[model samples]
Target: MKRALLILAATAVVSAPALADEALAKAKNCMACHSVDKKLVGPAYKDIAKKYAGDAKAADMLATKIQKGGSGVWGAIPMPANPQVNDAEAKKLAAWVLSLK
Candidate 1:
């Protein structure tokens, strides 16, 4: 019983950050255009992770894109720049998106 309880606690601890990051995404309105597995206005987070999977600079590039926005990569529908998301918040969001992989 104690071992089961310990496992539950460990799972919670691991899941908490992921939940928090998702919450952050929602708060930033990222969820309006993006989802975990399904494509919305933007590509799915998991797809982004898969596309950038072995990339050493994905996090940084994604962070920059998060803040500055980019186009022609995903499609013709250019992603407008997010002036609301600061640099640090952009980095965190990018990291979380990449973690979906």
Candidate 2:
């Protein structure tokens, strides 16, 4: 009983951030082209953060790019403009993606 309770408590703690990530990902349509561990059209979230590792401006740059849309950074496939994501949301999403590292 004690072990089961501990497990349940651990799951509850872990699920919060996972749920938050999923919520933001769904809201931003990130699941359409990206995943936490794998790639679809664009790079994986982990790969993106790795590529931009240690850069102070990564959050800002990524947020702008997410809104503006561009290509050739990762590959020929272009990330479409996401007018749906406002600046604040973009920052949140960008920071989340970068946190994948």
Candidate 3:
């Protein structure tokens, strides 16, 4: 029973990030505009990774940009401001977005 409990704890720890990302996505209302593979109002995650490839600062830059909201880079369709997204969540989303490459 103790070993089973340990395993459950480990699994919870490992799954936390995925849950956080899912929650963050929902909280940020990402589904209304962007997707991991296909273009919506904004470019796809794959396209973002492709554009910012090789840049070490992509996470930082993207996190800030996502929080503040911007446009012209991904076309005239302005990305809506996401003040609801915290810095940690933004960073995770940015990393996940870049990872979609």
Candidate 4:
């Protein structure tokens, strides 16, 4: 019982930021084209994390891509520029996506 309680508490602590970032993503309309574990219009967050694993610059690159949008990386559909998401929110979303690995 004691161990279970501690584990649950730890899980909750770790989940809070993830949940918050997910909410942020949804609020920014990211979820319309992206999902965490599976491909949608865009690649899954997990896949992105896998591809960029061990990349020290992945977070910064992803943040810029999130705000300014990019094409050819994920193919022809293209991610539209997210003018509404500021740098901090974009960075937070990038960190969250990378953390899915």
What TM-score against the true fold does each predicted structure earn? 0.95, 0.83, 0.76, 0.95
lDDT of 1 by residue, 5-90 (tens): 99999999999988998998899898999999999999999999999988999999999998898999999888888889998889
lDDT of 1 at 22: 93
lDDT, candidates in the order shown? 0.92, 0.88, 0.84, 0.97
lDDT of 3 by residue, 1-88 (tens): 9999999999999878766775677677986788777998888878998999889999999999889998889888888789998888
Error of 2 at 77 (Å): 0.9
By lDDT, the better pick of 1 and 2 is: 1
Q: Which segments of model 2 are wrong by more than 4 Å?
A: 1-11
TM-score computed on alpha carbons, candidate 1: 0.95
How many times do residue backbones clash in model 4? 0
Candidates' RMSD to native:
0.9, 1.9, 3.9, 0.9
User: After aligning candidate 3 to the native by TM-score, how far in Å is the CA of 39 from where it should be?
Assistant: 0.7
C-alpha positional error of residue 14 in candidate 2 after TM-score superposition, expressed in Å: 5.1
Lowest lDDT 10-mer window, candidate 4?
Answer: 69-78
Residues 19-84, candidate 4, lDDT per residue (tens digit)?
999999999999999999999999999999999999999999999999999999987899999999
Report the C-alpha lDDT of model 2 over 1-101, residue by residue, as the tens digit: 99999999999997787679669878879789988888998999899999999999999999999899989999999999999989988898888888875
Off by over 4 Å in 3: 1-23
lDDT of 4: 0.97
